[model samples]
Target: MQKYWILSLALCSAPLVSAQSLMVTSFDSIAYVNSHNGIQASAHISVKNTSASVKDYRLLRSRIGTTGLVDSNYFCWDLCYPIWVNQSQGTVTIAPGATANDFSGYAYVRDTSANGQDSIWYTFVNTSDANDSLQVMVVYAFNRYVSNSESSLPLLSVYPQPALAGQRIYGIPTDALKLEWMDLAGRVHQVITQNDGSITAPSAQGIWILRAYFQNGIRTTRVLLR
Candidate 1:
């Protein structure tokens, strides 16, 4: 179920008019697991204001879910907390031709839930002088189950196909898969145990190749991380 909060005009700034507007240009989501609890997210938010009047907004409130896993490393997952509101909101005033390009954050399940024992959900709400509201939802999980047996054996996908500078490498596997990341000169960087995942390229800036291996001696294409 979805939730929301409404504000009265008296609560807003006097200079903010009703004509201010907001436009969402992009939205996306992703899921994965690292050393402990897994996280599923929908991020990558970009917005614009097309209204004639100036717009001011603040990300003031948020809702987060919890997992009951009680492993010894429970505290390690706090880094996954969602706090974009505290970092991005403050007197964010935008002019008629102005824009905000980057808006993103993460929410994850803590190591307190029994395996396969919980459903996670969170919603972030923002407020602006124009009374505009933006809400985003994130879900975290351990693993995904599929009922379809007719799907292909399994596949891996790497994004930004050509690769670019200062960009994180994004990858996803279609089925249960294990991955090995290697550098061009035959060095094993790190092994990814999860299906849907991402890794940063070598910081020095050069062409690097990633070879992902799966069970049954099957191998996917080599990716260029530049």
Candidate 2:
């Protein structure tokens, strides 16, 4: 999806090399994203064969760091693999100078208690030669914060009606599940969780619409920042 392109390539970059065969395109060079937990977030990308000869390509996954808080992450090329599997189970044939956009990545976070963030590298390799490969890196983020713009319940209270930017506001709910600061149009600007006892105002000056999530329902309040 286009969301994937928006979050791409600062995490993964490589200098030019000779005899390139595989090239990945149509997605951001580096990407970062924040999505809801317990649901699958997917990104689709295309690969082209820059070589003059036909190339059989297979997908592979390489992790740069630990997979913390993420329940499972997988990729699909010719076939979708289970979470325990890292590479494609099958291969796809690409003609010389042809491109294919059949690669999709999936990630799932099973709970909201812990925030999940994973950086993964996906590569397309020539089946005949391991040296011929193209790789891209993407960062997936899912935090304990959840957003509900339509809740009518009074979830949390803002201590100061007129607070300064970056000022911490108290009176958070005891049973609060998550917190988000949004604009009047309901666009989330910042996310605050239990680790952050009270949410702080952003540097932007305006009427900050603070929303809180709870077991029963969501609540909303407003705080003016100078």
Candidate 3:
């Protein structure tokens, strides 16, 4: 039987409105969450800046999920903090009473497999000064069904979250398998032979599902490109 864990994509709004150099104003439209070994989840993100001064900042997005009855938390964001790993970075200047949108990359969650609740968190950093301040926006997505494909025997892997045209994905164990690229409309667009365990994603917009089949079985995963 394929193990399906239910996760809730709950949206809780909190404002880090303070006298800091950086702040996380809001997060919206987070979905298609994925996890592996009951540990991590990754997805797309949108960020807005709300702070005083011409804030030169970066946005880091990450997820911390449940592990068992006891959950494990892994983070992929902008700063190399104790709780999260830095994934991507960009500089934006937030004018007083102005906001900036960051749609740069993927938010990865690590070690999220506990059959409990999970939370997605974001951090804003002021890159202009090392001594500058930071803020966090943590939202919990509850009652989600984690897929069997995410933690299958073959251990498939994908890369460059917020993937581009040129990035590579690997971890399939053999050849003689087929790769299919499908859209949400139930249409298959690209089919390529799986060779040397990995393949490059096409240069396209929106979300794509990649499926692979081997002598043993089949597995599927998701990627986002913009």
Candidate 4:
């Protein structure tokens, strides 16, 4: 069976009298099924300037473990920067107390092994001085198992089709492994893994996707909130 591995890393710059400090505020993990074509994951990285002065920084370098791989092409926020094989990207300046979001891109794993571990490291440096920098690293591991012969997944049920505010929706299903709720933007809203098969609707009025992972595969259903 196919499985996904996810890891998140948060880094804050060192405190120096003359140097500007930046902290990673929205770093999250992503996962996808491994296939012969390739294993891919989409991630969003963001940082905020916590210092008193404006700071100019550049993505100095990025390194991926031998087991995992990332392509040179990536989509950035202000611009679409192309990453070379050496893993170098463009630069940006952040105002004091301001945040830079939109470091979104795709990561890939070429190896289709049964089990393995890999890591990705991203280093950012001050444009003025190379000595001032910060590094963030993410480690991930995954294992694949034999797929079950059954072709159909277990039936899943959710109560109160149009869930109301402050209402907890009960999800009923057999042999459930995990459940995750995410908004349309792909941001994870909530996760439940005890196999109790219950989730609470978010206060926002919009459409959300509920994904239920089982031993064999995954099932997704759309949920609406009022």
Go through the candidates in order and give each one's C-alpha lDDT. Answer: 0.39, 0.62, 0.47, 0.56
The best-first sequence of candidates by TM-score reads: 2, 4, 3, 1
How much does candidate 1 score in TM-score? 0.36
Winner of 1 and 4 under lDDT: 4
Q: What overall lDDT, based on C-alpha atoms, would model 1 receive against the true structure?
A: 0.39
Candidate 2: lDDT over CA atoms? 0.62
Which candidate do you rate higher for lDDT, 2 or 4? Answer: 2
The lDDT of model 4 is: 0.56
Instruction: List, residue by residue over 2-98, the lDDT tens digit for candidate 2.
Output: 1111233433453322338867656645433335422344566767888899989888776544766444666657865655677776899999999
What would you estimate as the lDDT of candidate 3? Answer: 0.47
lDDT string, candidate 3, 14-89, tens digits? 3343425443344443433434432223332334444456767665543443433213333323322223334444
Cα RMSD for candidates in order: 14.0, 16.8, 12.7, 11.8
lDDT tens string, model 4, 157-209? 58788788557887557577777776654445677787655677787887775
Please tell me which model should have the higher TM-score, number 2 or number 3: 2
Residue 86 miss distance in model 2 (angstroms) = 2.2
Off by over 4 Å in 2: 1-19, 29-38, 144-226
Clashes of each: 7, 7, 28, 1
Reference-based TM-score, model 3: 0.37
On lDDT, the candidate that comes out on top is: 2
